[model samples]
Target: METFKKGTQRLTDNEVDQLMKRQPHLLKQSYDQIPNLTPNSQEVISRQATINVGTIGHVAHGKSTLVRSVSTINTVRFRQERVRNITIRLGYANAKIFKCPKCPEPQCYQSFSSEKESNAQCELCKEVMTLVRHISFVDCPGHDILMSTMLTGAAVMDCALLIVAANMPCPQPQTQEHLVALVITKLKYVIVIQNKVDIIFRDQQAALRNYEEITRFIKGTIAEDSPIIPVSAQLKYNIDCVLQQICNFFPIPDRQLQVPPKMIIIRSFDVNKPGEKPENLHGGVVGGSILQGILSVGDEVEIRPGRQSKNGNQTTWHPITTRVVSLYAEQNELVYAVPGGLIGVGLLIDPSLTRNDNLVGCVLGFPKQLPELYRELEINYYLMVSVVGAQQQDGKTQKIAKIQQDEMLKFNVLSNETPGRVIEVREDKIMRVALNNPVCTGLQEKVAFSRRLSNKFRLIGWGIITDGKTITL
Candidate 1:
């Protein structure tokens, strides 16, 4: 038995270790009786079932503000985004919905509360209850020139929140384009967020008119059935209702971890600090979502279309092999990564090779498990009835011209965008395209096609990759 002096005495480290070893049952008992003090400790542990929801709308339409409202971590990474007040690249944030113990109603709790209070009591009831769910928000840029970035963000989303500002007229240019993209991406789950209600809080008639216009515009679109929730993300008004709708609509998709691990690299960077010792420096980190299977730490991985190399008169892409040193989901360190949400993978590779997002658009997977690299792709595409987001005369949809042979086009697959030329147009609507840069993609993968109309690449349509090959031309 260990005895202490009447006043107080501190045990030496060796003595403490000896006591713990001799009375291991004491330690076991202490461990077994440990209480879960986390406020939502009783909540269903479904962290692995993370749902990805994307924000798409016109520029200055509160896409970033909406994400900032709900997310615990700042999704905006670049200083330029803060300065310019527009998302230049894809931004991600993790958020949770918690239920109030005192309130039986669904929307009686906070929706956009800070994550620092994750384990704190409910603000309204002051009682702790299990959190309802967790979701990842993908903030897509609304700028016209960044349409390709928006399309890529839409690809990985299970659901979308199409934001429309109430102060502005309904169906802003990007709003229409984003809705079209939802249809092209085959996204069935959607919620239309009519944000900035506070801007028109005093103007009831104007707010009603804007709402009606927005409803009319979305009538024939794919989002026709989506619920329109009026919110004030800036003022944190009606955010709870938005969260309730999301919970009801966006359920987790079935993921198969039995298949080979594969991930699309959306953003990559060298994370080493300046003046850090070379021996202590960490490797570069690749951030994106896993499409399928599981990637565990220390797993050997290969990145395809890895680095550009000049082979005589032609350019070639060689696969790069590296080991995953660490894995992270949101801000939490993860031992293994699974499908359904975004992840960050730390790799044991040369930092210089991954700096400045050089590895962006590359595909990561086990050796020989990635799809074929293609310089030429055959796609069966369909043109939209009207050119989306384009200025139309008389407020009517305008007919777009069919793709012509030998015409230059832009192809977007996953996050990779490449310039290509139409080589062959088939009667069955299949068009063969020769890309200027090679891409790592699989058959049946959805690809968005754009045309240089009026000197800008406007999204025309999307198609599945049917065939790919190395073209000599």
Candidate 2:
């Protein structure tokens, strides 16, 4: 122990030592391991689809059961006590687009056949199936209290699958919260899965009526016109329909970009074992969905949090390596993963050096576009009607400057949320905003612009920030 202690003392300075004392759970790396990117000649890149599905509603609503049914994997069973211990779990499944080989007519298999035999025969010579690899789905928890978790999963999603129990037609409190979150995330594509339909199957007419009532409630919401697929996870009824719907909703994505490395770190943790060498502790494991470009092992990346630097510098950047010891998509290993997919990358850094929330609003890239700073940005938002004057701990409502259309607001934007001033209002509807400080933002970046009224901050609405410069509205 003494020898180990002395060895560890050499790796981290007194500052890190003092920090680890308070957060003992972070003592993953003992003394020598920190991530370092080594240059390599072999680079493997793959194209994969990134799908995020959230199980939302009250407790015991079968959110977990629904995800387990679709993915055939049970995350809750493994760690029931800690559902959202990490921001998200990475899941992979196979997706394919087969060309009808047996079709008497060309391209007869374009539409999926209802019958199994006909589908297998392809109605043609022989169907050619392309194994679309790297389709990832993020199974999110649905508790109202776990809003943070839901939002995290919602942040990077192609679509959402909102699961609700059929017996309970009225949207639960958590369901409402999930709806709000989906709106805030600006996720347009969503499919409502009314699970546990067995309970209501006896009363089909009542069940249909209840379903219609719920649909009416969701009118004008993000789930507008979203097909409500009813299924009994326990009985496996309509499971195939759910699968087909997913494929139809989200087709295999095509390769879009080839330059720059854009990686989003989703999960990070320290792997610590008893009586183990401190250096063996697996350091920071940052995982994210790469939106564009490709990242390879031994690539040098700059980790930039959205916040400004302490020096008052508008931009901050950190160099880290692709010390990825293990890279998995969904649950399969890959030599290299590309954008358009979800992947959990194991970094070779001391997990203690970083925190999960730190990477929430961060971006990783090469020297090019290292520090992204934006001055003026235009955004579309929705007002939170319930976000009226909020009382503070002192029982006084916080003061919020009156925002007018065409006016520019000044404030800060962090982790997809904007807390800024109301500069100008235009046409009584649109308002312009100027951030107190600049952040690394981009076009179509989902942001929750908030305003402080009285003692509480209220979310105005969620939208993408377009045009980094000044906006007219």
Candidate 3:
């Protein structure tokens, strides 16, 4: 390492002032900031590992239950209930776990329900021991209404955990759709979870039949050879075995100087404080796992747009200066953050610097390229088209249109969601996507599109733009 001269040993006060020019909210006193760390300090403290995980399957398949059963959150709706309460249950939960929050008195009070049990149980040590050091689950919405959310969540996953009911052997029609969404993300690692094993205890033959059918359905799919662990999320049987397999299959990546300092903005928002200075419009905070890299205060960063370019074209990007005013890893703050851990960064920039009304999804890091846009793409899709529709080309009105179930299509990529014609229809494999308009794309960038149907945005498929060349409509 090179040494700095006496004059350059420290950054000037004006230099920091200039850096915080755009994001003054990050300078707040309460913001938990990560100070610069020495090389040795970064090596001593073991950073928690971060793995993006998503569940794919049909509705009511216990996709959400599996997550709630293992995380800090609990869906009270799923708990055994009486009809007297008359509460409609809509169960969906999302949670994050860091090295458990070490607290002396970790219990929070709860209201009495039936004039008894007035005290809230200690939530701290309750499942603290079960907390996976560096893993968090992206609780996915299972019903048809939430397929888009599921698909987007899967795009960022390092691995996909597919849950199949042990009682329901064959893949449901919706199961095929979920699989197609997973394929769009281009995620390679997958684990098939054979859930509700208790159903098979009474009827051995039925269980065996279901197993064979399920195996046959996924024989050539992404999870073909993945270990299928028979589990009961309700009964809590073989849960440890599932966790062990996950740990063994998806071991955490090492966190050291080797990793880069990067963070993806999965969530961003603004807040208001009473009796505060009016001039202080705090820059929004972005949250996501540090894919690779170290982040500290006073670093120059970039916020890249998530829009796809029209046609295959390269776009230029620039970096913005933002101080690490505050940092939270699994809800706890560290002096200096490390990689492989989930972090929420308080960026030092104007609130308007972000887009989409502060919606989370855009990525943040060192910006160099304009991220790229593409028009033409080749995708391997699972088309669940009806038999009648599949025979002819009058599919302009159907959900998946005139296509065979489990068929793949090549579709053109576009910026806004607009209806387009089929450029070229090919047999089961590679098909050319002829977009009605132009879109930009860069080499190796993954892009996704879906059908604009009435019920839901049925997932089409995602593919990397091969040739970064622009195409005119």
Candidate 4:
């Protein structure tokens, strides 16, 4: 650590001022100005994304391909994902949306990759376009086995892009299930992307029939009014129209700056290379979007349900404490980060603790200000009418039954997942669960439930934390 800091120097006040003049998102201090910050504030969106837009649909429907077409990023980076040609983990990328104030209607809007200059010139107008929205794409896996992972991603989503294949019939298996996850998560804003239009382009009547099928599919769902944009992600056709629709349809959500800092960890890594010099080794880096409040450089933080220990048949969790060494949004460094785009927090801790996403799903905040660690939860549950993502039997979807005692279920709480068993049921609407691993959660946090069917877990219901059993530090 000393070697890593030996030649480096902190920026002077003049340097900070100069950088802020060019990159308005640098080294933000003072909480007093937070209340005045809007989603489109030049200081905010100019540097970092304030909206989390998720890409979701069935597997092989061009979800990742569409994101790559717009953002120029291939969200699938893992070895297995590349090998399997699927998104196994929740993938992320950032894009900046700019609009030419003088241009007409749809042609005015354009989306550039994260590294693009905030004030880029418009291609059509030849004038500087103003940055309107910077969004982080939470690319969720469409595989049935990763349904709970999708549910966890939904927790941070402000809006979603439902990518449906133009060639396939409406509502594929994971497509239906991902939509249901969005509904239960209460995500209101959605944009439906009819990708792979090139495949069905030659058949005009079939295309129209498929379009009508899409319209009917979303008739009563959350995306009922969402614009269905047809495009070929592979050929990058009509992608601008998709960008225009995104800018027009999705409204920036209300940001929370007055509350305590809350962040859900989706990915954590030890960025050090193999066999690096001891003096050059840095600490662990944790990445996720802030839920509320502000995180600053040098502030001390705590992670809940941290490390586990067992003593004589009793298990205990110890909260991990560390100080923030740096903050980042993608490759852009930030002195402070608020609730908005995904944030990467550098910590002064052992790299092993965060290597390979060891800290994923943990909640981070100011010490003693975080929520309780629950070993058991009492929730007011609502079971879905049918099991989602499960294959139909005898031409009928599998009906979800009531919560049964001793039956095991999968629960996703704030990006953290745990296997839970039904311990008790009351009034047929309330249930008690014993979690296999403790979770750090606040009261009334929405929890998505899945039950195993045909040897695979299917989304069965949802619940709210009415009460819980907590363990001592």
Which candidate tops lDDT?
4
Error of 1 at 151 (Å): 0.9
* lDDT by residue (tens digit), candidate 3, 43-77: 21223235656667766677666765655344334
TM-score of 2: 0.65
After TM-score superposition, the amount by which residue 139's alpha carbon in candidate 2 deviates from its true location, in angstroms, is 2.5
The number of the candidate with the highest TM-score is 4
Q: Give the range where candidate 3 is weakest over 10 consecutive residues by summed lDDT.
A: 109-118
lDDT tens per residue, model 4, 225-249: 9989888999988888888878878
How close to the true structure is residue 126 of candidate 4, measured as C-alpha lDDT? 84
Task: For candidate 4, give the lDDT.
Answer: 0.85
Pitting candidate 1 against candidate 3, the one with the higher lDDT is 1
Using all chains and alpha carbons, the TM-scores for the candidates as numbered come to 0.86, 0.65, 0.62, 0.93
Question: Clashing residue pairs, candidate 1?
Answer: none
Each candidate structure's count of clashing pairs: 0, 45, 27, 0
1 or 2: which has the higher lDDT?
A: 1
280 Cα displacement, candidate 1 (Å): 2.3
